[model samples]
Target: MRGGPAFEVLFNINTYLKKKGLRDKFELTFFAPMEKPGQKMGDKALLMMDKMFKSMDIHKQVGSKIVAFESDGIVFENGRKILSDLTMFISAGTGHTILSSSDLPLSEAGFVVTNEYNEVEGFEGIYAIGDSASLMGAKWRAKQGHVAEVMAKNVAYGIAMHIQNIDSKRSYMGQLNILCMMDTGNGAAFVYRSEKGGKMIPLPIIGHWMKKAWGVYCKYSKLGKIPRIPGM
Candidate 1:
C-alpha cells in the first residue's frame, strides 16, 4: 500500500461528483491495510493528504488487513465491516508471474535482481530494466516513469559502449526520486521527493495544463516528430 493510486482514485471520484454538483449527496471512504498508505512521500505530504480527505468529506479505514469481500460490504482483520454499494480496489505491485519459473535471481517481492546499470549479474550481456528489475536502494523508493527512463537510457549507453570497446556507463541510481503530477479534475498537484526531502505543491488550473503539456510532448517525442527536451 504505497498510496499513489489510491489517492488518485479518491480524487478522481470526488472530482467527478463535484462536477455533477452531487459531491454532497454521496459518501466516500478510503480503505487500506497500512497505517499510512503514502508513507513513502514523507510526513508532510502524508499530513496534507489527511487534510485533503477531511476537506472532501471522505472517511478513512486504515491499519487493518482486509480479510474478505462480502456481497454488501468488505471485512477487515480487526472485525470492522464497511458497507458499500460500489467499491474500487487496488492491490500492491508485484513481479510478473512468468518470472516465478525463471532461474534468474529475484528479490523477496519477486522482481529480477539488477545492478545500478540494470545489468543482470552472472548473466553477461543481459539486462533487466523498468518494473522488471528489482530496484537497488532505499526501501522507500518506488518505481516511477523517470526512473525507468534513466534505466533504459543507461542500458542503451552501456550496450553501445560495450560494442565500441569503451569503458563508460550510466546509472539509474543517481536518478531515483518520486515525481508525480496528480490530476484532481479541476486542477492538479505536483509531488516530488528527492534526497533532500519531499514536497507537495498545489497547482490549480495551470497545473492541470502542465501535465497535459507533458503528455503532448511525450507522445510527439516518442513518435520522433519533435526533439525531446533534455533530461525531461
Candidate 2:
C-alpha cells in the first residue's frame, strides 16, 4: 500500500477480516517507501494508524525503496525480498506527457500551472481543473476527486460571473480538505483533514450503507437524473 485513504480502506478491511475469523486464512502486509506513512493526515491520524496496526496484527514494511516486482513478491533496493502469494501495489499518479508539449505553463511534474480559480496563466479565459492542474498550497496537498470537483465548480462560477460582469468570484484555495469515507467490507471510517487538524470517526455497520448510498447519489447526480444537494 502507498498509504493515505487507500491504505485506510485496507486497514479497515483487515479489521473486518479479523472479526470474521478469516484473518488467519490470508496474509496481509502493508509496505511503503516513507518511514511515516499517513502522517499528512495530522498527528492524531498518525497515532490512530499506529494503534490500529498493533491491535489488528497487520504487518508493515516501511522506509524501504522498491526496486522491482518478481513473480512471487517484491524486491527492495536493500537486496531484501518478501515472498507473497499475491501482491497489490498502488502507484502514485503522474501528469500526462502531452502537457509538456503544450503552450501552458507547467510544473516540474508537467501539470498545468493555474491560478486559485484554476485559470491557466497567460491563457486568459482558459481554465484547467482536476488532476491536470497543479495544486498551489501545502506540500501535503494531493489530487483527489473531491478537490477536482471543487475546482470544477469554482471555474464554472468564475466563468458565469465574468460573463455577467459580477464582481463575485470563487476560489478553490479555501476549500481544500481531505474528506473520505474509507469503507471496509463490513464498515467504514469517516476521515477528514484540514489545516486546523484531522479527525477519524469509526462508523460500524451504518457507515458501509452510507458509503454505498453516496456512490449511488454521485452516479445519478452526475448524469443529471437526480437533484444534487448543495455543497455535496
Candidate 3:
C-alpha cells in the first residue's frame, strides 16, 4: 500500500485476518527475490518470520513478478507456485502510479524531484515530502514513519525560518535509520538499523507490557495529557 519495510504491512494483514477468522482459509506467504529475505528486519526478526511462516503453513518462494490469480494462489518465474484465494500488492518503492496524475517532473519511477531541502527546483513556495519526494541520499534509503515526521517538522521549521528571514534550511540526509519494536504474542524485539548495520534484541513478557504501556502513552500524549519521549 505504501513505502517502508514489507513486514509491517504483512503483520497488519495477518492481524486483520486472524480477527476475521479467515486466517485459516487463506495461506499467507511472503514473496521476494531473495531466498533469505527480510534482512531489513534484522536476523532475529528474519528468523522469527521464518518460524512464523513455517508454523502458520505459510509458504516462502523466490520470484520475479510474483503474480497471483483466483485459481492459483501465486505463481513465480520458475514455474513454482502457491495457490491463494486472494492477493494484494504492496510496493516498497516510489509510488509512481499516483505521480503520473500530476504535471511535476518525475524520476524513472515517477516520484517528484526536489532539491536537498525538499524544494521543487523551479517552483518556489511549493515542496514535496515523504513518499512523493525523490531522496537525495543513498538509494537504499527508505520512506519510514520517522522520516515522514521529520520531513513534516522540517518543512514547518523552514517556514518559520523563512518568516524570520533566515537563509539555511534543514536536510533529510544523514537521518537514514530504522527503529521499531516488533511485537510477538508474549514478547517483542527492539530493532535498530543505521549506516553501521542492524541489531535485534529480544525481551520476554515484559516487552509485551512495555508495548501496551507505549500504546497508552501514545494515546494520552497525542491527546495532550502526557508528554512524549524524544525519539519515540
Candidate 4:
C-alpha cells in the first residue's frame, strides 16, 4: 500500500468492471503477502478496500521476488526461474531526484519544496505540484487527482492575487483529504477523509450507473461539449 502502483491499477480495473455490470464473471486474483492488504488510499478508502477484499474468496501466494546476481535475472521464492526479456528499469523516483537537484529548494525526501500556495520558496513565478512536490502536512497525504486540481486552481488564484493585489490567498495545507470512490465488482463505496475524521459510504446497484455517468461527464466536460458541475 506504500505507493504500490499495481494495487492502484487493480482498483481502477475493479471500478471499471463494476460500472460495466460485469463483475460476476471476473475473479480478482491478488498476489500479495498478507491477507488484509494495505492500500495507499487513506483510512476510509482502506476500509472500503478491506470490505471489498473480505467479500471475495482470495488465494494467497506468499512469495517474494528475490533478485540474485546482477548479471543474470533473479528467481522467485516459489522456486520459479524467470529469464530476462529485455530488462528495462523505469525510474519512478529518479525524476523527482532530477527536479530536486535543480537550483531550487528541496525537501529532505528529494522533492521540490513548495508553500501551501504551491509556490517554490526562492523561485518566483515558479510553482510545484503533483508527485514532483512534497505535500507538507498529514502523514497520510496522497498524490491524487482532486488534490492536483485544487493545487492547480490555487496556483491560478495565487497568480491572480499577485497580479491584482487581492487579499485572498490560496493554501492547500489544511485541505489535505482522502476523498475517493472505490468500486467493487458490483458496487462502489464513497470514501472521505479529513483532519477531523474519515468515512466510507457503501453504494450498491444504482451506484454503478452513477460511476458510469461520472465517466461520461468527465469525457464530455474535458471535450467542452458539456458543462462541468460545481465541485465535480
Per-residue lDDT of candidate 1, residues 57-167 (tens digit): 899999999999888889999999999888778777789998878988999999999989898899999899998899988766989877888899899999999999999
Residue 22 C-alpha lDDT in model 2: 92
Looking at candidate 3, the ten consecutive residues that score lowest on lDDT are 1-10
Give candidate 3 regions above 4 Å deviation.
1-28, 34-36, 41-58, 85-89, 92-98
Name model 1 segments beyond 4 Å from true. none
The residue pairs that clash in candidate 2, if any, are: none
What is the alpha-carbon lDDT of model 4 when measured against the actual structure? 0.65
Displacement of residue 123 (Cα, Å) in model 2 is: 1.4
**lDDT (Cα, 0-100) at 202 in candidate 2:** 71
Ranking by lDDT: 1, 2, 3, 4
> Candidate 2 on 51-120: residue-level lDDT in tens?
7677667788878899999999998888888888877777766679888878889888789999998988
Error of 4 at 170 (Å): 0.8
lDDT of 3 at 217: 92
Residue lDDT tens for model 4, 12-101: 566677678885756554444334434434566566665565565422333464434245444556675445432223123533556855
How much lDDT does each candidate structure score?
A: 0.86, 0.81, 0.69, 0.65
Q: Candidate 3 at 141: error in angstroms?
A: 2.1
lDDT of 3 by residue, 1-232 (tens): 2323355456556666777889886667767755556566556656766776675566666536555444646677677776665665565465467678987878787788987678788887888888888766753355677787788778888878998999869977767777776665456667777767676676756876787898899889879898888766
- Record all residue pairs in model 4 with backbone atoms less than 3 Å apart, i.e. clashing: none
* lDDT of model 1, residue 190: 82
**Higher-scoring candidate on lDDT, 3 or 4:** 3
Q: How accurate is candidate 3 locally (lDDT)?
A: 0.69
Whose lDDT is greatest here? 1
